[model samples]
Target chain A: MSGTLNEARLMALYHNPSAASELDRAIAQDPAAAALVAEWRRQDAALGALYGPVGQEPVPARLRDIILQAETPANLPRSPWQIAAAAGILITFGASLGFGGSVLVARSGASPSLVADALRAHETYVVEVRHPVEVAGSDAQHLQAWLNKRVGMSFTPPILTDYGYNLLGGRIVPVDQGAAALLMYENAEGARITLYIAAEPGQGETAFRFDQEDGVQSVWWIDGGLGCAVTGDLPREALRAIGTEAYDQILPAET
Target chain B: MAVLDEIEAAIPALRRYAIALLRDRDAADDLVQDALERAVRRRADLRGEGKVLSWLFAILLNLVRDRHRHLTRSAHLVPIEAAADQGLPPAQDGSLALTEVHAAMGRLPLDQRAVLLLVALEGRSLAEAARALGVTEGTAASRLGRARAALRVATGRDRQTGTGGES
Candidate 1:
């Protein structure tokens, strides 16, 4: 019932002859249609002839190993952000572990774990003289302004004078659900503190948590739905004290 | 357990598809390796038990397309003859079918080439080819048409038929 097969339909039928019954009927009715069918069949057969059977080739053992390795938990390399989040998880749990609430559900609470994660993140990257913060504290005005805009509040760099910490700078870190702000500070003695801030965690979580991992101590809390964590090598008491002061200054309405 | 075993069994099929698509044993191996690596990495992402071959085929096609784009940009056409040594038989002067077929395939554009291999070589259905190529069934059919036509032209069969079916 056709003069010329539509290129598109011809293409479809060419790949799957079983579905081309109408075309086959048209071919049976017309000589030209019959020849087109025959020619197309030869082309298909020729294409099939191009490559010999491929089933015998060996799947390289190394390739199989690589794929299988990816399945194992240990093979999953923790990104810096994941590591930081883990620390935050610990900070949340650690605080809850100390304070004793929701003892059954380990890492479910929001503010505590989030704060904990940030503090842990701070501990990770604050000490490096190079790349301490994304935008250096040398440009304090710009750094503060940029972070203030991004973190959705006016930010005055928290002063650590009483704690012997001076502002270093800050950077941006991406988390699973949202963004994080990282602030770095260094003491005259070259000790460093990192502040990581993000949104609160799951419901019924701690307001404060202190944790230590890999020689770094972090204190984390939630204020106004924002999770904040302070990380350092300082004693847990000192870190907690620093966290409390920073939280008070950051969370309280500015006079 | 059955799904994993099925996929494990399909590895040989995947490698075969990849080999035909890439035309080089080592490169085909590399492509299969990357696909399997991804499959293992995101095992939780597997949709169902029986779709392993389709999944692997999709991954292999993506790799092939990516490499083809990269190679095309580099304009490197390392002839099939140069790459087809070792496993291939020495030209016995008779039965030029294999050589002609290889040359014909090497001349197809990537889309057409993928369709021909999936439908003709791998014996995948039009629907399966469409899924592997990430195209609609109509698009797959059209590509298959052009692929077969191109092969006919490349193999000199189109010339023997006279100018009646010529386009």
Candidate 2:
């Protein structure tokens, strides 16, 4: 059967069922289309049965909490007090700028504010299979150059061969400083991790802060004038070792 | 009566779609929660012409695609064998070839998988699936064909398998 006619036949069975009889008659002229439709129906039935239970299962409590929290006044249309609080926080950061580097500090590690953005980005991008990075890992130099150009910081993709993670690629992200960058890496086991960097000129050095959500672990720190966060699903010890090594390689180069 | 109530009614189906796509319960709920939250945040943007369920499914599908975009190609794994017997049909429903189907579905590519789930499993009309994915009906049809063919090969059940041209 010609490709177009064969497609029309199969499509007739699958989508445009009103025309299925005509297509089936044409498909009967070709056994291939009929067999294909049969198999497709079987597969569809299987898919329906396998996943249908999940919807019937009890909804997880955490999901409800997520919705409830998202609906809270702070996250929804910000209440007047919430808007004023945001203004206060911005003014606080602006005032902190006067302090010398290493003096302007947060409650802990990379500041409390940046942690949320880093976590959110980690959640969003780490699940991507294709187009994970704007520049593919095959061209490490281009990935670095692209991120550097977009983020206005000379950043290098850390070599994590020792830790079993090679550079997958990098992309530019938004931060309070206008631009940030993230380089994702994956190991032989297929576990993905990323290192996020932002220019924190004149900001204080950070004590490493760690966070975990949905089985993924993350660590953030500041070295020199750059604020960095490294996040993944690795064990705390392993993630820290990798984060520390990356810090040694990239941050020290800037100093 | 209310848009949110309408949205609440669709949660089970949305959750089912998410689970079929991700194959993980927590991950599926996470996706469902994200869709619902986005719906609330962008409530003003939804026009009455669009059904709340369709709009919510669109959001869930987008989130799945976003996850697909950042995830590595090597990480696709389906433990269909273990989970195969989890869905035993009631005595009258008859035996189902669910495990084989799931394994095959899991091995298929994401785009194909999405098209198949929306149409074959979810009972979404071809045009509705196309609208949800923001693709033409023909594109949706083409994806479905490829998806079905791919499943046949993956399942090793391509009985009467004439030379396949995926037409």
Candidate 3:
């Protein structure tokens, strides 16, 4: 086997078929080339065997936690859209309501406890793989009816396509207040926003309320005695937009 | 997220690749974190869910390259020796041959190392490896050849010596 052909064959071993055949001819002609190819394969195998287990090693939780952290001042968006919205909200509430602006804030005014429960469920289920929802979006009608019955009213699966999210599915999860209907929507990127809704026995119609904690944002509201919350780790404005979209599209309540 | 679980599922693999690239466990985790943060931040741009892994790898590789360039700019070459000292995992304890194999890999030039790791160690096909590395199949193939050849020298297990002899 000519040394040139052997080199080509050696290179071909890592490439497509045409180059692989050249190794066959080279091996027949040159014993050295055959031995070299054999040794190279052994090295390749050794390296793979040595490093393969790295994949099996438990991933450090810190890696995932980093995603949830509201990045430091250096990493925070310098001019987020939420800044403007926050200013607007600030002007409205802090004017005559300066006595207890913090307490009078929309987020704390609505069912704060229920909003926390909804955020928990969103975080818990958003990362789920095999069973995020009991009934997928394929059976949207059944899912709607089932959830509506479970929660004692129609839980309108919000239309979010205009905001780049399509309904993935929904489920029912127990909340501190009562059983809540959880509907998950996904955008093209697999980023999901979960909406949790349940009948509020004593709560009445309320205004949009935004809550931010640990980089997860959830907008909670009460509409006609129904509590609704949309949660995700999205830009503030985006989450507000989703919350508003879902608010406008929610199924009407029974008088 | 529709494919959020799927992306999350690939974390272990990404961590492994990061470990191979960065050598130190803490550094690797940091690199993975940065990659995930960037991916999550830019989630809206990820239209093709099927390419998520490749997309993540591309982002990871970009971060690695940026860090390396920054380090190099500061006059520090990549800490190849750190990986050499880390050696193989505990399971490979007492396996000097495997330790040498791991060290030999660390000694590989970054280009060749990436190509070899993607194709040979990580089991990516040539096309997929090329896609991940942003190179042509021919370039990836050639780099792989050079990497294997370099390993043969670094490990001193060439044609005559490496003849079914490393037990």
Interface RMSD of each: 4.1, 4.1, 4.0
Q: What is candidate 3's lDDT per residue for A1-255, written digit by digit as tens?
A: 244554644555544444566567767676766676666566656766666677887555445344323222322323665356435544543363444434434547657667766766776678767667777887978988867755656557878889888888987775443356889988999989899887776677887787765567778889866789889988878888888888877866445
lDDT (tens digit, per residue) of candidate 2 on A127-165: 667556667778977777766645555667788899999
Candidate 1 docking quality: incorrect, acceptable, medium or high: acceptable
Runs in model 1 deviating more than 4 A are A1-4, A17-26, A64-255, B73-76, B82-96, B160-167
Highest-DockQ candidate:
3
Query: Candidate 1 chain B: worst 10 consecutive residues by lDDT?
Result: B86-95
lDDT of each: 0.64, 0.67, 0.69
True contacts kept of 2: 0.53
lDDT for position A182 in model 2: 78
DockQ, ranked from best to worst: 3, 1, 2
Residue-level error in angstroms, candidate 3, position B101 = 2.4
Candidate 3 vs. true structure, TM-score = 0.49
True contacts kept of each: 0.58, 0.53, 0.51
- Evaluate model 1 with DockQ and give the value: 0.26
Docking class of 3: acceptable
In Å, residue A60's CA in model 1 sits off its true spot by 2.8
Which stretches of model 3 miss by more than 4 angstroms? A4-9, A12-33, A66-255, B47-49, B70-96, B159-167
Give the range of the ten consecutive residues with the poorest summed lDDT in model 2 chain A: A69-78
